[model samples]
Target: MSEQALTLKQSGIRWLWLAVVIFVADIAIKFVVMENMGYGWSNRIEVLPFFNLLYVHNYGAAFSFLSDQSGWQRWFFTAIAFAVTGMLSYWMSKLPAKEKWNNIAYAMIIGGAVGNVFDRVVHGFVVDYLDFYWGTYHWPAFNLADTTICIGAAMIIIDSFRSEKKSD
Candidate 1:
């Protein structure tokens, strides 16, 4: 039997589906959070000793960078997220289907980026709910999108190292 060539749409499409799933889940959870929790620091529910569900609007990037700015950061971050999502989509499309790690990483990044972008466009800030802390020290609250993006980034880093090791 002869080997058949797969078209772009037939290849690496599963990764795109994963991206869609992530996007949907992210949006849905955010909606639930918005519906149940009050805006800002009003309605906080402690879920665990080191975790809480709190509503926070971040008008800036990670760790609320530039969050104190005069509101220009909203559009700026929205634009950046859109651009990154676009780039990651393009990159994912170009990858071979067998490159599972890279595909998954790109899809996750794209999904997370789009999720945050939607928040910025709709609410003028990203909605963050998950809060983790230990004693008096608290990690900045973040959402599923942020968590997925960090996981994807870490996977990409690991993939790079694996590739380098293989090449050696």
Candidate 2:
């Protein structure tokens, strides 16, 4: 194998640790929200021109997409979650060494994906909260895991652009 790849394998502690941290934190927060908030409990608080805190539970994917599916979807989504978690974990492990930011980004994505997967396995669905709205328009409710996934994906994209620039 290449020297850089070997180095990455040896320096993977930080990546693994970051994933553990994000995963633990996500679990703790979700537990608190679930235990305290109660199912479907929501409170509205306008913080911006178009924002509100509306607690919500999600039974399916983004925007309540496929939320009304029959019982079969649970196992299907569980399988999907397992596949995604494995792929992301492998990707995180193979990240090049010294790419701290890149590793962090990967760790965040993997952690968040696994966090939601845990929920899917145990509860058969992900629990989403934090609602935003603008008059009659509303964004889908999401949670910390979702936020981390989005931000990590953004960082990955930004880093890809930065790498291409450097290569050029």
Candidate 3:
């Protein structure tokens, strides 16, 4: 293979390591929460005025959408996660090695997707904790995978604007 081709391939593989790290961390943290924390909201352990370690099982999409449905949502979301991961992998492979921000974003997304998919496949739901609240209101509980996905999405948005500004 050409030197350029070899370099690109190596770069792609290196970027994928970030995904693997995120996936492992997400799974490990979830496992710890599962082992130490009790299930349901009644067992929340307050770590701060605005934060708590809580356990929640989300059977549907973000914010528990369709969680009330029969049960098809589990497989549906799982399939979606797999599809997204595949697409991100392909997209990352196509990106230039110098596009660090884009690659990082893709890696985070792929990792997070895999993490959630694993949970859905094994537990029939996404295991969530890391609760944040304010006064009488509480944000929907989310795990590291969810946080990584959101951060990745935000990074992508920021990179898009930066790219646009550079072109202008």
Candidate 4:
């Protein structure tokens, strides 16, 4: 660990609290969904004309990719999530705490990744809710963790553009 990392407030790792918050909230919400809702398409509760609360388990990554595979994907995704969380946490620890944008973004991603990983380990699948649809077409159901991950990834991309502008 570097000198900066030794100083608790000085390191961007301070933002890890946000990650913990996100992780806890994600897990609690998943629990709520599981306990309250019956599984599958038939049990979905329409929240709005275009939205629904649907509890489903995703055995694969986003959009249920490779969800049909014979069970290996759960471990694969869990491993990848932990690797990513580790890398991001390391980066956060090295960065100055003043680097709010990237730190927050990384924290969000780390939180989401860990949340999903927990699901894979405990339930053998990621529990998904929140369905959005338009007419007969429907977008994939996802949860708060996915939302945070996507938002964090977008923030990182946006940060790249800012860095480029500053350099140029």
Candidate 5:
């Protein structure tokens, strides 16, 4: 292999490492919440009136949307998660060597997706535990993986708006 090719391989490894770190951290936090807090429970550590350390499990997509569907939904979302992870991995490989932020964003998304995918595969659902609310209305409960995925998606949108070139 050429010197440039070796360097590219090394760079890709670095990005994969980043993804691994996020994935581990995400699972670790979830494990703690699951083991200690229990499902559909909350330990309110009110950072603000609208925020709390609430624990809830989601059987489906964001906000428990479609979580009420028949048993088939779990496997369906898991399949989608695997597909997304594969696509994100591909994007990471072609990511520009100098665009560290962009690479990190892709890593975050891939890591988060894989993390939740594991839960779906193993438990047939996702364990979500963070809660945000306003007045009597409550936002969906989510975990680190979901937050990272959202951040990564936002960065991707911003990057696109900035007209960054997709490196081959």
Candidate 6:
């Protein structure tokens, strides 16, 4: 029997739907948070022993890096998101449909990045609401987009350990 060749799904762009879903869900939740919740730490709603719904904004990247800058970081991060999303989409188009892990990971990153870009463009900052804490200390606030990106990044890292022969 001959070795079967992999078909990368109409160039694998099909996987991008997962990205779109993430973008839509993130934006929709942000909209809900903005419409129903008051902003700032004083307005946070305690949801559980370790979590709260806190509406806030991040003007910079992960962990609020550069959040204190005047204003240039907004466009800078937006530009980076555009470039990275484009690159990931391109990679998805070239990857095999059978490579579900990598394709889905790329789609997730694309979705999450685009969602954050939308926030940066429309609101001048990313909307963060989910807050976790340990007694007096708290993890930096984040949103669904941040969650998706982190999960996607982890998927890619896990994929890295797989034998490359699986792809070929």
Q: What C-alpha lDDT do the candidate models reach, one value each?
A: 0.87, 0.74, 0.89, 0.94, 0.80, 0.90
Regions of candidate 3 where Cα sits further than 4 Å from its true position: 1-8
Task: Pick the TM-score winner.
Answer: 4
Residue 79's lDDT within candidate 4 is 90
Clashes of 3: 0
Residue 143 alpha-carbon offset, candidate 5, angstroms: 0.7
The ten-residue window of minimal lDDT in model 3 covers 5-14
Tens digits of per-residue lDDT for model 2, 29-148 = 888777766466345455677765445666777677788987576667667767866776667666654768877877787788778878877877887767777788778888878888
Stretches > 4 Å off in candidate 6: 1-9, 164-168
User: What is the number of residue pairs that collide in model 5?
Assistant: 0
Per-model TM values vs. the true structure? 0.92, 0.81, 0.93, 0.96, 0.86, 0.91
Taking the tens digit of each residue's C-alpha lDDT, what string does model 1 give over 142-164? 99999999999999999989999
> Candidates sorted by lDDT, descending order?
4, 6, 3, 1, 5, 2
Whole-model alpha-carbon lDDT for candidate 3: 0.89
Total clashing pairs for each candidate:
0, 0, 0, 0, 0, 0
Writing each residue's lDDT as its tens digit, candidate 4 over 1-168 gives 876447867988899999999999999999999999999999999999999999999999999999999999999989999999999999998888999999999999999999999999999999999899999999999999999999999999999999999999
- Return model 4's CA RMSD, one decimal: 1.8
Q: Which residue pairs in candidate 2 have backbone atoms (N, alpha carbon, C) closer than 3 angstroms, thus clashing?
A: none
Q: Which of the predicted structures, 1 or 4, would earn the higher lDDT when compared with the native?
A: 4
For 67-104, candidate 6 gives per-residue lDDT tens digits of 99999999999999999998998788777766788888
On residues 88-140, what C-alpha lDDT tens digit does candidate 3 reach at each position?
A: 88787777767788889989988999999999899999999988999989989
Mind giving the per-residue lDDT tens digits that candidate 5 earns over 34-111?
777745544655678888785677898877878999878898888888898888777767766566877888888888
lDDT, candidate 2, residue 160? 89
For all the candidates, what are their Cα RMSDs to the real structure?
A: 2.9, 3.6, 1.8, 1.8, 3.2, 4.6
Q: Is candidate 1 or candidate 3 better by TM-score?
A: 3
